[model samples]
Target: RAAATSRRLSHSQYASTTSGGPLQEAFAKGALKPGLNVVLEGRPKQPNDVEGLKQCLAEFRQQLAWVERLDVTLGQLTNVVESVSQNTTDKDAVDPENDFQREMSFYRQAQAAVLEALPRLRKLKVPTRRPDDYFAEMAKSDQQMQKIRQKLKSKQEAMEKSEKAKQLRAMRKYGKKVRRSYKRDISMTRMWSLSEELRN
Candidate 1:
């Protein structure tokens, strides 16, 4: 029950508080440590999985504009979660596949906000050393990202098509109304001209 409530509050905070500037700045400045945290390491691997830790070194380079990359990373994280949901077999799963899904989602959202705050962290000149197992860790993250993306492809494309169809329908409806109004105006103008000629 508490977890569910926490999840709800996280959702509220995510859509509002952490979506803006100061919290992001704190992350960039590496100042707020007692607040929100999103730790994904040490998660139990799936039976078929071979990788060990997820997400490696987001090296905050001093001169680099890390914000854009961070934004992309967040988007990618969202895609990962979506792909997992689309591909999972929830019915036959061990505690049900949807179990922990909410928590994982909250994690990614929080991580995204924290990452957006990376600029201030960079500004603070936080010295972060690359992990000894950096390459392996990165390979794991890459593999997961790719796996999710591949799984996501078909569903994502279908969703895009649906969205496009809706947009097209709306546009066509608006266009039809505009065309009717335009035709009426043109006819009115012609009738006015004819009346003036008749009067002359």
Candidate 2:
């Protein structure tokens, strides 16, 4: 634009300033230094300086064309960048592997929990062996028990003499079965241990 405006204005300004026309020829002869003139290196002296104007214009048009191509390339680059960014966003929103990964992580946590509880499971396990003196240790002291026949004879004598003893025996006609009917709060593991010890 600067080149075009200067080209046109130089012609008009010269025409206006040199209306007398002889001053124009004298100024040309003076060989003044050029300022802001769009000069094409060569010109046709005989026909006119018209060829110089055409050359300068052709060069300017070529430069403008190069600028237009750069703008087109920049637009294409912007579109490519936008497409890549949109694809990345879509991938982040949903993916098939995420569910599988979460399930695997949950399974891993369950496995770790089981592993951590192994020592407690071992501690809860019922013991298989009973000591050699188990029955000896379980028996009452000698004062609490004597020969079975002798004890029974004494009991029978007492029951016959004591009215209270006779009435107690009559009331207990169901015998040990009534005591067996009641439930105990003992755990299965403890029962298992007892049964194992008494297996012999």
Candidate 3:
């Protein structure tokens, strides 16, 4: 009997909490439903960080000023694909396999960019060409270059030697053939002279 009484009290406590808690208030206001599986929309919006935003804006302005001072920003280049599509009526002009038209469009765009950039760069006094006194370091060391050169020279020499040996062998074979023919001609002459004497 005591166990039954305690179980009833626990059930009543759980019922009270479920009925009078914040969830019940939400359900009463139609913000929550009993059986529907849906996301709640009554949550408050996140507060913005005003100080953090100000800091970010300040940093962006500094970066913009630096870029302006350097005058490195070329703004935006014209879209080659879009321009090609607009200028040409052929359906294949924009196709990737149509390399000629695509390449020509890119070339024209690059040319235009160079033409536009040169004047601006000149006005800003930016150096467009490398100085004559500037010297670039070679990618390969001098010793490595020398080894490559030696290897190429040895290979060429071997090729030339092989060609000369081939020519000599061919000449020797031709000389042997010539000598055999001359010997045959002498023997035939001798036999013919003997036969003529016998007939006389």
Candidate 4:
């Protein structure tokens, strides 16, 4: 009889407290505890009352099982959300590969421009007689500067080629004598003679 009454009273309490903020607050703070009662004192229990008590206990256990399942589902959802967020952030932080490719592309363009200018540079003219005084006579415009630079580059290349040709000719002529003179490098005297001949 007591257990049956207790269940009924508990249901009534749940209904009354459903929209009560203080009741929820108290439960959260552990000021309330849920329980099932079977009897109060020595008394012959009613069969109908025992059945009612059984029903209440069954319902309470089922509600608890539902809450536990919801908790587990929520925990799994939180882990999935955290993993997705980290992957997105890491992708944003990563640098792109195209930056290196873009730099290499710029370098290739610069190299091509230099190679294409070389042939045009070779045919340009420069006066060899007044090498030091040429800059003073050249005009100070972009076109004039470019033309002068091309002429100077061509003259310098021709001079270097001519000098190399002369060296090869001299080596062919005196190479046998130079080798017979010493097993080591050419002596100081030979080097001086070579310098004077180049200067002349």
Candidate 5:
């Protein structure tokens, strides 16, 4: 009896706390009842971090105006689009299914980009060409490459030698068969002449 009374007191306290809401009015009218699945609203949201947002925007603007500024020409973009449109119109001239046309299209676009970019880079005073005295380090040492070439050459030579040997063996076998057949034919002819001479 005491436990039942404690539960009723707790339920009344919960009901009082949720009294003014539409859900409580629905419960009062016996239209809807609260269950374990029923969810209540959480606490209101906290204020946004305005200072942090300002700092982030300032940083973004600084980065955008950095030493290496990005410049996109509307004219160049339009030219590229026009070129693509023209290329598409001549689909019959260059097969759409062929990879050659696709590759060529990419090459032309890249060429145009390079042509446009070079002038801008020069204007910006950026180095557009490598120095004559610039030396590039190769992935493999000269000695290692030479060794690889030697190995490949030796393999090729071995293959050629084996092929020659095989051809020679086949020729010797064929020649031996031909010599035997010729010798047999000659002996038979000689025997025929001897038989004729005996009869005479």
Candidate 6:
């Protein structure tokens, strides 16, 4: 559950300005400088350090490459899950052993990818205030989740109401049939005419 929560946070937090605050601060404070699109550390008033920048860029580039690869891996896993869902819908379908093995392999790869990327990201020496920033992000996420839950609850209620109406109609139809089977008070022709009139 914690792993799932972290993955959700990683994805959700990616688009926010706060996502790279620590990294951004390193650059802003002259602890890390951008040298031709690469990152390097230097004295506050010093010129660009090309070699240090290249090394930092190499590490950052590798991390981004890993992230991209992980995304592709995730997409493949999603496809496999979608296929599994489709097969499960067929009453007679059975899951093969190899499919499960492949799914496990995909999950392991994704987990490994995330673990590898995290270390490289951390190596930037970026400092961040924990608990405070984290708590604020959690509050925002919770609010969004609450709104989603409310929408889902209302939709479920509507569906339940619709299903109840269908069941009531079925029960009424069955009741009429049962009564007709026991005794015939209205003639069939007149009953058909009455039903037509009611429908109109």
Best by the TM-score measure:
3
Which clashing pairs does model 1 show?
28-117, 28-120, 28-121, 29-120, 29-121
TM-score per model over all chains: 0.29, 0.15, 0.37, 0.20, 0.37, 0.30
Clashing pairs in 6: none
- Whichever of 5 and 6 has more lDDT, that candidate is 5
Model 5, 53-119: lDDT tens per residue? 9998888875454226655333334443444456565432444575765566566667776787787
TM-score of 2: 0.15
lDDT of 4 by residue, 30-56 (tens): 666565222334686756788889888
Q: What lDDT tens digits, residue by residue, belong to model 2 across residues 39-102?
A: 3448746766788989988878654542234231111233323333455455223234556544
Where in model 4 is the C-alpha error above 4 Å?
1-139, 178-200
Report the poorest 10 consecutive residues by lDDT, candidate 1: 49-58
Better of 5 and 6 by TM-score: 5
RMSD of each: 27.6, 40.7, 14.1, 31.7, 12.7, 23.2
Give the Å shift of residue 54 in candidate 1.
Answer: 42
Model 1 misplaced stretches (Cα beyond 4 Å):
1-148
Query: Model 2, 34: alpha-carbon shift in Å?
Result: 88
In model 5, the number of clashes is: 0
- Candidate lDDT (C-alpha), each: 0.68, 0.56, 0.75, 0.60, 0.73, 0.66
Q: Best by lDDT, which number?
A: 3
The candidate with the higher lDDT, 2 or 6, is 6
Give the candidate order by descending lDDT: 3, 5, 1, 6, 4, 2
* Candidate 6: tens digits of C-alpha lDDT, residues 4-63: 999988876874555467666665666664452325446458678999999988888744
Residues 1-200, model 3: lDDT tens digits: 99999999998898877745666667767777556433466897998999999998988865454326644334334465555666656533466676875687667767776787778778868888999999899999999999999999999999999999999999999999999998998899999999999999
User: Model 5, residue 40: displacement in angstroms?
Assistant: 29
TM-score of 5: 0.37
Off by over 4 Å in 2: 1-97, 126-200
Better of 1 and 6 by lDDT: 1
